[model samples]
Structure formats: C-alpha cells, structure tokens
Target: MSFQWTFLATFLYCELIVVIILLLPFISPRIWQKFFNSRLAKAFAAGAKYYFNFIICVFGLLFLDSIRELRKYANIDSKDLSAPHAEAHARMKQFRSQRNFYIAGFALFLWFVIKRLINLLVACAREMSAAAEAHKQAEGATRHLEGVMAKDPTKIDPREIIASPNNPPRYVEAKEHEFEIKKYKQEISKAKEDIDTLRKEYEQSMKKYNELQDEHQKSQIQLAKLSDNESSKDK
Candidate 1:
C-alpha cells in the first residue's frame, strides 16, 4: 500500500479503537464530562471542527479517486484483456481501488459516528450534573422550610400579650393600639405565602431533576445498544 493509503488505514483503526473505548460501560459520564471540560480538551475542541472538516475533504477526495479507478478498471477494453499481464495488472489495480474505497469510506463514516457519540455522552453528562444541582437546591429549600416552620409566628401573638390581665387596658387608644397587631398579621400572612412559594419551587426542582435522570438513562441505554452492535460487528 502507498504511504497515504497506509496512513488512512491507520487512522481508521484509531477511530475504531476510540469508538470502542467511548462505548465502554466502565467509563462513566462524569469522567467524560471532566475530560471534556479540561483545559487541554477545550483547547483541542476549539480547533477540532476545522480539523475534522479538513480530514473529511481529504478522505472525500480519496474516495472519489477510488471510485474513478474502480470504474476505469471495470470498463477496460477486451483488447487489453487479451494480454494476461495486462489483465492481471488491471485486476490488481481494481482490488487496490476497492480496498482504498472501503478504507476511506469507513474512515469518513466513523468520523461522523464518533462525533455524534461524543455529543451524546457530553449531553448526558451535563444533564446528570444539572439534575444533581437541582436535587441539592431542592434539599436546601426543604431545610429552609423546616427552619421557617419551626419558628411559627402564631405561637406568640402580640394581641394576646396586650390583652393580658397583668397589662392595663387602653380602651381610649384601642384603634391606634391595633395598628401594630394588624401589621404583624399582615407580615405573618406574607411569610406564609413566601413559604408556599418556596415549597412550590422545591417541587418544581425535584420534577426537573427526575426528568433529567430519565433522559440520562435513555442516553445510556442508547449508548449501550450502539456499543453492543459495534462489538458484534468486530466479532
């Protein structure tokens, strides 16, 4: 094989190995997330698009060339086939062309597959991370609600204190004296509303977390199926 063709074959092998590694069940999404978020990975990702495009272009040209060679050999004149040496040479060229076609085609195809797999894994990782954060927030809200409930304002009434037998009744200034009592009631009502709102928020966060977990599971199942198929093909 020519150096270029050999290099393409080597690259195709590497791509296959990478796909298998990525699909391995042992590697968790969190590890993939950490790797993708690393500075080196980020730097590589910044230019990966352009590099992938260039590779696609190169492989595309090679694939086309292989097709052209295949067709050329297929259409060889009967006059050329009359000579055994010419016939053998044409057959050899056709075989090489076919081999190159498969190599280039698989390389290009695997590139796209690998890219998609990485995206799927990354999305799963991010969803799992978000779900965890939401769970934490929900727990915090629950704790806050517990603390607020523990300090129930209804246990201590300003009106009850003012109306106590030990205190002198101010009947003449009753209207003015009730002002503080009304303000406290309003404050207590507002606090209850705030607590309700917080409870609702916590519920919503938990719901979101559940949805993310479902999506993550689906992604994992899909990845497992894909890996299984690939492994079967290898076998």
Candidate 2:
C-alpha cells in the first residue's frame, strides 16, 4: 500500500513538471502578439499561468508531506530525497520566472514599436495631403500669371529671359492673342446685356418706318383722287 501511494505521488509530480515545461513557451511569448492575434488565447494563457503555479505549489507541498509519511510508516531510504536535488529544482523554477519576466519586457517593446509605426503612417498621410494642396495652389497661381503675361508680352522681365535662356517662349505673339481674347469676352458679355435694349430700339424704328410708308401711300391716293376730280370737272 505504501509503495502504491509513493508511485502515484511520483507520477503526479512528473506530470506536473511536464505540464509546466510545456507551458513555459506559451506563457512567455510577447503579450502584444497574442493580444492582436487572439484575445481568447491571451486570456487562456494568462489564466493557465496562475492555475499552473497554484498546482505546482500544491503538488510540492503534497509530495513533501507524502515523503514524511513514507519515512514514518514505511521506512523509506532518506538518501533518495537529497537537499541538492530539491535546491536544483528551486533554481530551475527561478530561471523560468526570470524568463517570463523578460517576455513581459518584450511585450512592452512590441507595443511601442507598433504604436510608433501607426503614428508614422498617419504623419506620412498628412504630409502627402499638404503637398497635394500646395501643388494645386501653385498650379492655379502659374495659370493666373500666364494669363497676365499673355496680356502684356512686350513687358517681359529681361532678368527671367537671361536666367532661363534655354526655356522656350511661353507666350509668342501674346499681346495680340491676349487683346483678341479680352475683346471677344467683353463683346460676348456686352451683347448679352444689350440684347433687350437692341430689341426695344429695333421695334421702335420699325414702327416709325411703317408709319412713314403708310402716310406716303395715303398722300398718293389723295393726289390721284384730286387729279381724277379735276378731269371730271373739266369734262
């Protein structure tokens, strides 16, 4: 009976050690990786650590008590449970704990790295938007300046011509072209506004011309009637 109990206790202790060793790799990976990849995994892992630690302590205490009971009831050899082996196990546990501590530090480092990367992306987007806006504004200003130069090509800056000798003329025969464009635009606007006035004047002139023509026709008829009356009276 004592041998069976000792064997069972040894088996349980071995199982616990196997579980702890297997779990160390999972528990010590960067926290952010788990947080981003799977929240459920991260939670499970955290919970597992606590439960595993509790089980280890419980088993250690149980094994110590079991050894004491074996010594009293069965007279097992004391040489088998050496202090050096226990001390070595204690040191191994301490190493595993330190390794886990480093994992926490790695998690923090990864978090900062990801955060800075996001910030850089946002900043780049902002800079691109600003550059695009500035480019649009510059294009508009260039167009406006070109129009001004077209209107007075003869007054070009000699300094610009000298500095940019290789650059081709942007506005050849510009003064005439600019004047014609300006004149056409003005005529178009004036014609639209003067349409009503022109219509009114045309109607008035037509009325005057019709009245004169009618008066001339009536005088011709009156003269013909007078000539006819004189001929009849003479007869």
Candidate number achieving the greatest lDDT relative to the actual structure: 1
lDDT at 219, model 2: 100
State TM-scores per candidate: 0.58, 0.29
Q: Lowest summed lDDT over 10 consecutive residues: which window, candidate 2?
A: 99-108
Look at candidate 2 and tell me the lDDT of residue 60. Answer: 53
Model 1 agreement with the true structure over 1-235: per-residue lDDT tens digits: 9998999999999999999999999999889989999999999999999998999999899889878877877666778788769888888888888898899899989999999999999999999999999997777666656555686544433332345578654344558759888899999999999999999999999999999999999999999999999999999
Prediction 2 global C-alpha lDDT: 0.57
Q: Write the per-residue lDDT of candidate 2 for residues 19-62, one digit (tens) a residue.
A: 44434545433333434348785567677657756655654554
- List candidate 2 stretches off by more than 4 Å: 1-82, 152-235
Candidate 1 minimal-lDDT segment of 10 residues: 153-162
Candidate maximizing TM-score: 1
